[model samples]
Target: MAAFNFTPSDTSLFILMGIPGLEAAHIWISIPFFTFYIISLLGNFTVVFVVGKEQSLHKPMYLLICMLALTDIGMSTSIVPKALFIFWFNLKGITVNGCLAQMFFLYAIAIMHSAILVTMAFDRYVAICSPLRYTTILTNARIAKLGLVGLTRAVFFILPEPLFLSRLPFCANQIIPHTYCDHIVVAKMSCGDITVSRLYGLVIAVIVIGFDLTLIGLSYGLIIRAVLRISSKKANLKALKTCTAHICVMLTAYTPILFSILTHRFGQGITPHIHIILANLCFIVPPMLNPIIYGVKTKELRDKVGKCRRSSLAATDFKPA
Candidate 1:
């Protein structure tokens, strides 16, 4: 296939507003983004360190939490740093190959995150509904295999998106409307008809997000039924408490995504701002709030983090001169 000679457009439609230009807005935006990035990094790293350091947390639920933290870090690192550089430094230009690569990794990690969350729901379901079988079913080998399956799903499902993007003829509009090279944004830049690309996007959305959400709902539904059957009030309360963190994380991850899709599909361009905001929220908000949710809802993690902090402080105080 022949390569398309694409000329970038001058208009910045979805570019950041409320500023003189990309450079100025980027500089201001970088301040908060950089801070959030640092916090997210520390928050996730703390979870990993605490889990890894303590043998007590080697169980299935904590293992799932560790995996979630890893995915959250991967998802955030894939996009935010590059976006900040492009917007702040006035380096808006990206080659076709470069744009496709960015989109591929971003979407892949995002899908992986969703898949892992679904697996976690299953983890919780088994732990609550079949406590005796939980250990036998969710062993270390099984958890590792589930992770590999999620990674494979992410890689295979996202392959068509970048491949389809590379085939499109990007005529005069090489400039993507958003900060990063998102799938829909890049598809809109194509001069050729994007019917196939749009269809693929919808299909993948259904398979990844739709299927995952459906399974999660089923898992929770079963869990709720099991909880109701428990005659003891203390047992029911404990089960509900155990699920609170996971439920909050799931809501945070899925709600914005659904809103983004609905706003884009039905609201048209009338609410592009809402779409943009929700898209970023879909990416950043979950990672940022996940650690906090776990900390507040799960006392074990909170105590571990507190202990880690105190140990670090004590080590600092006794440093060699």
Candidate 2:
């Protein structure tokens, strides 16, 4: 099929269709989107806040959780708010630069999030497989360096995207049939050849996700082996229990995204509306669920979150005594 490119140029503004088949439900849709956005904000912020305020939770694991929380915030904030605007206020126009910026943060932070998970996997591996060297191997300084390296890697890979996009001639359809400024979606609108954009997008995604997931799998394989060697049922269960939350989070982070990618590539029979909905869920669901998963699964974070909740209640419910 020929490319969707029609005009030679639009007003340098791309209009986003919040949901192709559900225009009548956009108002109702905004309810859930807005709710998820607010919940994601409050939950991730609480993780950051409680982790920062408490000295006991300053270890590598919690610090890495903090990093994940920040990325969750960035990743969700990149799309949800704008999506809510489109749904509720009929605001869909995004400037070329605005779209590029959104696309950058969305992709960069998502891959950075994958890197953080890999680092967290390493944290779990060392803690379980090399308990004595956990601290020595993953000091605060080292975690910070890992974070910097992850950020740098994500940025390095994604920085070329906007340049590739900018050089395209979007002479036809400035209207993207989804909620956000996805690279492939934007590229399809351009009259200019998008081979580079398509190839780079696929390559970067595969490299980051494939590499990190492989590392995560290896780390967990070692961890499971070490845990099994303990030989005591109670101790083995306890060790495995610690990995549950990370594994849950890993699923949430990758499942929807990988599904979207596969369907986009292979599920050609899938409707565009279904594709957009799945992609939207890919962005929002993880952010909303990640902090809650951590808060519920990790006793320390759960306790601290409870304590913070109690403290806030007490402050507001105070008597003049």
Q: Please name the candidate that would achieve the greatest TM-score relative to the true structure.
A: 2
Q: Compare the candidates by lDDT and give the number of the best one.
A: 2
Model 2 Cα shift for residue 77 (angstroms): 0.8
lDDT of 2 at 84: 84
The local lDDT score (0 to 100) that residue 78 gets in candidate 2 is: 96
lDDT of 1 at 163: 93
Supply the global lDDT for candidate 1: 0.79
The CA lDDT of each predicted structure is: 0.79, 0.90
**C-alpha lDDT of residue 25 in model 1:** 57
For model 1, what is the alpha-carbon lDDT of residue 258? 86
In candidate 1, residue 57 scores what lDDT? 84
Which stretch of 10 consecutive residues in model 2 shows the poorest summed lDDT?
1-10
lDDT of model 1 at position 44 = 89
In candidate 2, how many Å is residue 313 off?
2.1
